[model samples]
Target: MSIWEFANPRKFTALSLKILPTLVGLSAVLVLGGLIWGFAFTPNADKFESTVKIIYVHVPSALMAINGWLMMLVCSLIWLVRRHHVSALAARAAAPVGVVMTVIALFTGAVWGQPMWGTWWVWDPRLTSFLILFLFYLGYMALWAAIEDTETAADLTSILCLVGSVFALLSRYAVNFWNQGLHQGTSIPVATGGRTVADVYFLPLVVAMAGFFVLFVALVLARTVTLIRERRLAVLDAQEARA
Candidate 1:
């Protein structure tokens, strides 16, 4: 079947049930393995010492935060243009996950910064924009809760999400655009001759990123299924009430 076929609530629910278990299992395995390797196997950084271990979680979560917002933006666009209920539901499902990821990124960053930058927090460009992204997540979710009508809520929230897209983009490139902080440039990139982290450390970082992506997908799928069922039940209850 084509991709659009799964847009149906029943079809999506059935597919999610079949796939969620496998995703959950893999996510658990990879995350555990990554943590062990990152913390125990990798040698301490010459400068940052063992505290560099935080990169395993912090970097992945930061990447997810931006990607999650992008996912919501795309889903919101589809919802508005195609009037797809599933798209709107998916966007709603992703918001909480995105918010949590942002929190993880911010918390882990602060912990890492304490030793590296000699401060827990700073009003730097990248950090400041990331905080704004988190607030955007909160605002989007709150808007949905405040509006009683689902369609109206989706429409309004979609507009806000689109408008807030700049924050996500800015969060990533902020360091490049403005040099207002001590945050180092990309460590994984070769173009800048960044630090050549050992494979033992880098491998776990890869696994952790994969695990988080799978986990995010599983959560979004589970939440979307619940949303679809609730929406259906609401329609049925409304019909019965009218009758």
Candidate 2:
């Protein structure tokens, strides 16, 4: 069957419930297991020392923060073009998760930077763009919360998400665009087929990254299901009142 069949709320809910437990279990295993291995087993980098271990959280979170916005952008476009309620709700559900990821990334970056950069924060190109993306996530969620009309909220948030996508793109690419920034390059380079980091750090980091992505999917799926149910309950209440 076509993937779009999931656009139906009942089908989406059914599939989500069926897979959520597995996703949750897998995420916990990977995240917790990878982090423990990285912190306890991996050797400290000669340059950053023990502080480099924070990459397990910081890198994955930063990647997800950018990716989460891109996901919302895609969902928003789907809602705008297809007028699918599930798509809109999915975007709404993702905003909070995105914001939390942004916050974690920023906080961990600050903690990691203090010793390396000799400062907690800097207005570097990548950093600045990421901060802006964080603000956009806040605005997207605020726009949703402030509006009473669901369709209106969805429409306006979709526009906001579309506009905010520029920052998301910048957040991901700003390091490459502006090489002068203090932020280091990617640990794993896709195009180069080579990684800057060592094998010990690379394996755990990969596991952590996979864990973060799976965790993000689980959170968004759970949240979207709740939103769909809540919307259904609201409709039922309206119908009962009318009767």
Candidate 3:
């Protein structure tokens, strides 16, 4: 089958339906195990102590917050280049999930920061950029809702996503160029070389991050399927009205 064939709403919806159960079930297991290990089983850190436990949820949410926008950027590019309706709707479906992830990151950061940074919030580059990322998600969703025409809404939001992605990348890499803030430098590296976090904590953190990824995928699949159904209903309603 062609790439565009998968872009069909009905086809994509059917595919998402078949895969969602595994995604949901496995993610739930991983998240439960990670939480159990991170909070209850693992020994307290030598430095941060019990407070370090927050990293389990915080790091995973932060990772997803950045990646979710990147996923939307890719979907927006696909929609812009190939005019794929499924891609557009998928991007839309992922927006609120991204928002929730961003919120969790910010909230957890504040919780972790109070004892570490001595403040609930700061003007740190990383923190500020994350706030901007949250705003971008809101604006993207608002633009989509305000426009009545799906195609036109998709077009405008795709442009917004392409533009907002520049800032999102900046948020991720800001610490490298700019002054490192009260926020700790990178703790987790994907390849597991030159690691900062201990293996015990890192391992569960990895599992938690993987669970978050799977959870995001499940949400996007279910939400995109809903959007596709709504689109079909709108089309049929239009046809019946004309008939």
Candidate 4:
């Protein structure tokens, strides 16, 4: 009944495997549909013109990149407090996904920014913070790969994740912190009940963000399942060698 019950590797693996197919299918449909609608059907914006279309990919990915690190931060805290191997492994699994999302965001942002900002890159507060978050992701993954002991690796990486979260938080809020940045305000300001983007672009952008979130869940679950199996296999191999 409790959500924590699913923290057990066997239970987690079984449940994740069961839902993964649905998640995968839904993500693909939503992502493709949203992209088609946003890119093909929507008219150009008054200021940015066609370049504004990249929001379908850029905004979602940027949101995911920040939130993915937050997810890892939560997993890391769970691992630290509960000493759950699954939590640690989940954090590890999410790093690559987070990093890839960060890359896509950075690249797409550059593509979108060139025309608007008159340059490919700038040391804007938000952009700099996001870049720091990406570096932290790389460092976390490398720490996991470098340590031989699984528990030690998990402990270290969890700590690193905790530290990296500062950058993640900054990445999401740096634009607000510094008004001088070239980066504009949020496109979909749900909190304020007003949207800067028009309805045509807003609808598809929402769908794309939803799709990205679902895709992230599916990927993290799949990777965690694989890690659980690999850990079991390693234990079996160790036992056989001992025998």
Candidate 5:
């Protein structure tokens, strides 16, 4: 079946209910395991020492912040084109989570940067554009809140999301565009020309990234289910009032 079939509240709710417990359980296990491995077992970096461990949280959170926005963009597009209520609700449900992830990334990055970069803040292209992304998220949410009519809010937010896509792209590619900052060049362990971070350190970073992805998925699914239920209730209440 097409992806849209799953957008039905009843179908979505049933699927969510079936998967929720498993998702929650796995998320808790993975996050805790990842933290234990990252903090206790991972060796300190020769350059940054234990401070580098922050990568476990900072990198994954930053990546998820971007992924969450992309998901919202897709949902917004679907809502605008199909006038699907669930699509709009999913987009709304994703906004706060995206914002929270962005905040975590920025906060953790600042903490990690202080000892390494000697400053907690910078006007570098990547950092500055990420800040702008946070602002866009806030504005999008506020626009939705300010409007009483759901349809109008969806349309306006969709437009804002599309516009904000440019900034998101800039945020990702800022380092390449500007060629500035103390941020180290990208390298993956086991890849050609990769940084030779110790395996003790590398494993935990991988686990942490997996854990965060699980947590993000669980949050989105739970929030979408809640939004679907609330919308269903509202529709029922409206019909009763009409009767």
Candidate 6:
């Protein structure tokens, strides 16, 4: 009935077991297929040329990079408000994925930028905020690791998430507020894209985005299950000690 029913460990575990395999298989197929299509089938753009192929991975990685942090923020809020263990663990599960995606985005952006911008890095507003977001991910995870009490770790990490959210929001919109960056304007919407890219590129990019999204979800769910099982084992151990 209530969506919270899934928060129960048994329910979550059972449901996740059924769905995760499908998600994983679908993601692998889509990601691999999309990437192959983009690289092998799609022609080079007149502007970006061969470098345009990177968008298959770059755009999807960037999308997941932002969405992963947003997912953590939402999960953290739910943990704080509703005291859901799943919510807290879900936030924890998301952090490493977010960090990896952020790094991938930055790395790919640098690779893409070198030929275009003639530089590997810059302090442009968008880039700076994105770097800040990566730092926040590290700090959030580090703070969680430092705290010994699970509940305390969750509470502290949740607060850290709230603080870092300001930078995350800035990272998303900084391109709009300060358009002076070396990076080009948004282009995914096709309409807002200024007709810059060809339609042939859109289909693979869409598939790649969908694949990465599903992969991100699968990873989070898998990690959450591991965390929940670890927590359950700890509880059992404590009970055994008392017995």
lDDT, model 3, position 32: 87
> Model 5 has how many clashing residue pairs?
0
For model 1, the local distance difference test gives 0.90
List candidate 4 segments past 4 Å from native.
none
Q: Candidate 4's residue-wise lDDT over 1-243, tens digit each?
A: 998988899999989989999999999998998888899999998888898789999999999999999999999999999999999999999999999999999999998888889999999888998999999999999999999999999999999999999999988877766787888877676788887777888999999999999999999999999999999999999999999
Q: Is candidate 4 or candidate 6 better by TM-score?
A: 4
Compared with the true structure, model 2 gives a TM-score of 0.98
The reply for model 5, stretches above 4 Å from the true place, is 189-197
Model 5, position 23, has a per-residue lDDT of 89
Q: What is the TM-score of each candidate against the true structure?
A: 0.94, 0.98, 0.96, 0.98, 0.93, 0.96
Which 10-residue window in model 1 sums to the lowest lDDT? 186-195
Stretches of candidate 2 off by over 4 Å are none
Per-residue lDDT for 151-174 in model 3, tens only? Answer: 999999999998888778878888
Q: Write the per-residue lDDT of candidate 2 for residues 64-156, one digit (tens) a residue.
A: 999999999999999999998999999999999999999999999999899999999999999999999999999999999999999999999
Give each model's whole-structure lDDT: 0.90, 0.94, 0.90, 0.92, 0.86, 0.90
In the predicted model 1, the residue pairs found to clash are none
Q: What digit string (tens of lDDT, one per residue) describes model 6 on residues 68-183?
A: 98899999999999999899999999999989999999999999989988999989988898899999999999998999999999999999999998888888778777968777
Model 2: pairs clashing at backbone N, Cα or C within 3 Å: none
What lDDT is reached at residue 6 by model 4? Answer: 83
**Candidate 3 TM-score to native:** 0.96
Give the lDDT of residue 237 in candidate 2: 100
Highest lDDT: give the candidate number.
2
Supply the TM-score for candidate 4.
0.98
Q: Which ten residues in a row have the lowest lDDT in candidate 5?
A: 184-193
For model 3 the local lDDT of residue 200 reads 82
How many angstroms is residue 28 displaced in model 2 relative to the true structure, after the best TM-score fit? Answer: 0.8
As for model 2, its CA RMSD to the true structure in angstroms is 0.8
